[model samples]
Every structure is written in structure tokens, then in C-alpha cells.
Target: MQVEYQAPLQRLNTFGIAARARCLVRVRSEDDVRALLRQPGWDWQHTFILGGGSNIVLAGDVQRTVLKVEIPGRRLLREDERGWLVEAGAGERWHDFVVWTLQQGWPGLENLALIPGTVGAAPVQNIGAYGVELQDRFHSLDAIDLETGETFTLHHEHCAFGYRDSVFKHDRPGARGMGLRGRALITRVRFWLPRRWRPELSYQDLQRKVAETGIQQPSPWQVLEWVCAIRRAKLPDPAVLGNAGSFFKNPTVTAEQCADIIGRDPRVVHYPMPDGSVKLAAGWLIDACGWRGKTVGRAGVYEKQALVLVNRGGPQDPCSGGEVMTLARLIQTSVYERFGIRLEPEPVCVG
Candidate 1:
């Protein structure tokens, strides 16, 4: 375990919000995690597990010790007629891992290329894009119990993943409900890419790409190229613009409720889910309320996509965490008052 006192976190987080950790420890291995747990002053209960810092907004100088997971390794554990068992350290970059799988001729993860953050954080967010979610490829994962210092392995069933949510996102007790949030520190993740991988072009953007290119059967790498292109053209790169890809979760409503919404606003973009619930386009809802390109203090809604809240101020005068949340809350209030549905943020906010 590598330790640093009063670590500067401006560059650590993708949002570019300046913050500091009172103490930061980088665990390169599971043994390192155990070593960290044995430290005298470390407080496990308050320890914040930071991955790539892509999907977070640092509220201020964090009081708790930060466990910056830096474990790194990746390999094909095995392969068979069923599928290829792949494993990666928690600290491996999510996008890099996806590209690695494609290069290795493992086609299933191609649609998720170019996403930000580390592999360990993927399951916590159930990261999805172009109709493919982490749950679709996840085999299992290894995590350490911060409270007990005991290691455990959990399969997909134990994860209890929902739309951009998992057990890891919830705090036990209070809102307990099968939540393992703030408890397990994920160390590594394994994926099962099946032998018979198929393309997922059901999403509108991908379908449009297919239509424009006239490529009926695109290769996995070709699909990856398309996904990367789509993301680049849509979402702002964190390297240049400080923003988490999507700010709000797409709200799902019953068919009757959607029907009422459609009656009131015919142009409201919505999709009928297989479960009979209609998924409303959250960005469309925000845009309909005329919030696109609007700024609130240093924080503003992205001009291109209402779903993304960006730091309008550059590094010299970066937007604070408060500004981002304030803008988010204001947007949420407007959408709720007008549309009667709450918009949940995608990133984990911390101080």
C-alpha cells in the first residue's frame, strides 16, 4: 500500500473540482488492501473507495481517508465452448479493458468502448451504453469487506443490479433494502464473453449509424469504431471539458402515465420497454423545459445535451461541487414540477 498525506485531488477527479484527501492510500493488490486495513489511524467506516474518479463530484476536502484503488492486471483466465473467462484488476481503465477484449478477439464488450472510469467502478454504476449493460457480461467479482477485513466473492445474482444502480450504491440500514453500498471494496472483476457473441444494434443511435453506413453486418471492431465516434460526437471529453457523461437517470413510468404524458406533449420522446413500462428520454424532458445551454453560476447544462451538466468555468475558475449540485437540483425541481417525475443523478457525490 502506498500512502500520501494531504493529497491534492484536482486531477484525480474528472470533474476538475479542486479537493483534497486528508490521507490517501493506493492499494495495488488485495494484500495491500489488507495492509491498509491494518493501519493505525485509518477509519474503515468513513473510507471512500475512489476508482478512476470519472463518475464523482468531490464536494470539498474529504475528511475521511480515501482508498484509491490502483490494483492492476488483466488476462484471459480460461476459454471454452461456453465462454471466455476474463479477469481484470479493479483499477484497470474501463475503456482500455473493453478495447483489450476486442483486440483479443472477444467481441461482446465492443459496444461499451471509450467509456470513462475503472473496471471496478463499472458494476457499481452498472455502466451501460448502446443497449449493453455491465450485468450482461459480468461473471463474478472479488471484494473485501471493509468492516470485517474478510474477502468474499459474489456472482451477478448477489449484485442485484438495476438501471444504473446496484447494491454497492446504497448504504446499509436506514434505506437498507438489500443494499451493500459503502461496505464492499471491489478488488477485481471477471467477465464471461460467450462464444456466440452477437451485435446489439437495437439502440436508435446505432441503428442510425448502420442505416447511414449501409453496413448490415458490422464487425465487432467496426461497431467499436462507431460507438467511439458516436460518443465523441455527443459527449464532451473529460480531458477538455469537465463533466460526467450523463447527469440524470432516464425515468421509467407506467404505460398509462406515459399515455397521459403523450396526450399532453406529443413530441415527448419515449420508448416502450419489454416490461410494459415506458422509458422517457430525460434529456428530452429537460430540453422541453428550455434548460438546454443555460448556466447556473459556474455550472451549466451542456449546450449539445441537456442530460449532461458541465463545468462552464475553465481550470482557472473551475465550478465547485456545490454549483453542480445546485444546478442539478434546480433542473430536477423544474422537471418534477412540470413533468411529475424526479431525475436521479448518475454520479456519486462526496466530500
Candidate 2:
């Protein structure tokens, strides 16, 4: 385990928000975590587990001790006629892992290429893109209870996965729901990639790739290239521009609510789900509210994509977490007032 006090976190988070951690501890293995637990004066309860720092907004200097997960390993755990079970340590970059799987002839994770963050953080956010979600490929995960220092494994049904949500995002009450939020540190994640893989081209962007490229039966590598191209065109690389990929979750509304919104605006972008609900395009709403490329303080909306919030000041004078949230709130209020749909942010706000 590596430890640093008063650690500068401006470069840690994707937003490039200037902040600091009271103490930052990098755990490279399960043994590191266990060793930390044995140390005197260590307060595990108030510790914050950090993975890739890709999907977070640092509001201010964090008072809690930051535990940066850096464990690393990847292998084909098992394989058969059905599929292969792959495992990756928590610290492994999510996008790189996805690409590695495809290069090895594993195809299930192709749709999720180019996403930022680490393998450990994937299950926490239930990260999804195109027409695929983490839950779709997830087999199980291993995490350690911070409070008890006990390691445990949770399978698909135990995860309670939802749209950009999972058990890891919720706080556990007294013997109630299985909420691991802030209480467990994920160490490794396993995925089930089937032998008979099928491509997911239901999303409009992927469909457009099919039409433009004239590749009806796209290989996993082709799909990965296309997804990377699409994301690069729409979302700014975090290395270049400080911003999360999508600022808001696409709001889902009931059929009646959808009709009400459709009545208000004929050109509202929406998609019907299998469960009879309608998903509205959050970027479209923000664009309709005239927020695209707009700036407030040091934060601004990406000119190319309305769904992304960016740091206008860059790294030299990067935006504060407060400025980002202020701009986000203003955008949310405008969208709500205009469309009657409350937009939810995709990134977690931390301090």
C-alpha cells in the first residue's frame, strides 16, 4: 500500500476539479486492504473508495480518507462451450479492459468500448452504452466490507441492477435492503462472455454505422471501432477536455407523460422501451433549452454535445465542483420548467 497525505486530486478526477484528500491510500491488492485495516488510528467508516475517478465530481477538499483501488490482474478464469468467465482487478481501466477482451476474441463487451473509469467502478454505476449495460455481461464481483473487513462475492441477482444504478449505489439500512453504498470496496469484477455472441445495433448511432459502413453483420472489432469513432465524435476525450461523458441520465416517463411532452413539443426525441415506458433524449432537451455551448462561471456545456458539462477554464484555472453543480442545476431547472421532465445527473458528487 502506498500512502500520501494532503494529496492533490485535481488530476485524479476527470472533471479536473481542484480538490484535495486529507489522506490518499493506494491499495494494490486485497492484502493491502487487510494491512490497512490492522493499522492503528485508521477509521474505515469514513473512508472513500476511489477507482478511476472518471464518474465523480469532487465538490471540495475531501475530509474522508481516500482509498484508491489499484489492484491489477486479468485472466480467463474459466471457459466452456457456453462461454468464458473473465476476471479483472478493480484498478484496471474499464475501456482498456473492454478492448483487451475483444482482441482476445471475446465479443460481448464491444458495445461498451471507449468508456472511462475502472473495472471496480463499472458494477457500481452499472455503466451502459449503445444497447448494452454492465449488468448484461456481469457474472459476479468480489468486494470487501469496509466496516467488518470481510470479503464477499455477489452474483447477478444479488446486485439489484437498474438503469445506471446498482446495490453498490445505495446505503444499507438496518437489516433491510442489500445496499453496499459507501460500505464496501470492490476489488475484482468478473464477466460472462458467451461463445455465441450477437451484436447489439439497436441504438440509432450503431444503426447509422450499419447504414453508412454498409456492414450489416459487423464483427466485434468493427463494432468496437465504430463505437470508439462515435464516442470520439460526440464526447470529448477527458484527457483533452475536463468533463464527464454524459452529464444527465436520459429521463424515463410513463406513456401518458410521454404523450403530454409530445403534445408540448412535436420534435421531442423519445424512444419506447420494452416495459412500456418512454426514454427522452436528455441532450435534446438541454439543446432545446438553449444551453448548448453556453457557459456560466468556469463551467460550460460542451458545444458539440449538450449532454456533457465541461470545464471552461481548463487545467490552469479549472472549474470548481461548485461551479459545475451550479451550471448543472441551472440546466436541470430549465429543462424541467420547459419540458416537465426532471433530469438526473449521471456523475456522483463527492467531497
TM-score against native, each model? 0.97, 0.98
Model 2 agreement with the true structure over 90-158: per-residue lDDT tens digits: 999998999899888888999999899999999999999999999999999999988778999999999
Instruction: Evaluate model 2: give its TM-score.
Output: 0.98
Q: Against the true structure, candidate 2 has what lDDT?
A: 0.93
Tens digits of per-residue lDDT for model 1 on 1-351? 788999989889988998899988888999998887787775678889899998999889998889898889999999998889999999999999999998898889988999999999999999999999999999999999887788999899989899998889987756435567777999999999998978899999999999999999999999999999999988899889999889999999999999988998999999999999999999999999999999999998989889998988889889999999999999999999988989989998999
Ten-residue region with minimum lDDT total, candidate 1: 171-180
**How many Å off is the CA of 261 in candidate 1?**
0.8
Q: How does each model score on lDDT? A: 0.91, 0.93
The candidate that wins on TM-score is 2
Tell me each candidate's RMSD, in Å, in order.
Answer: 1.6, 0.9
Q: What's model 2's lDDT at 253?
A: 96
Question: Least lDDT summed over 10 consecutive residues: which range in candidate 2?
Answer: 171-180
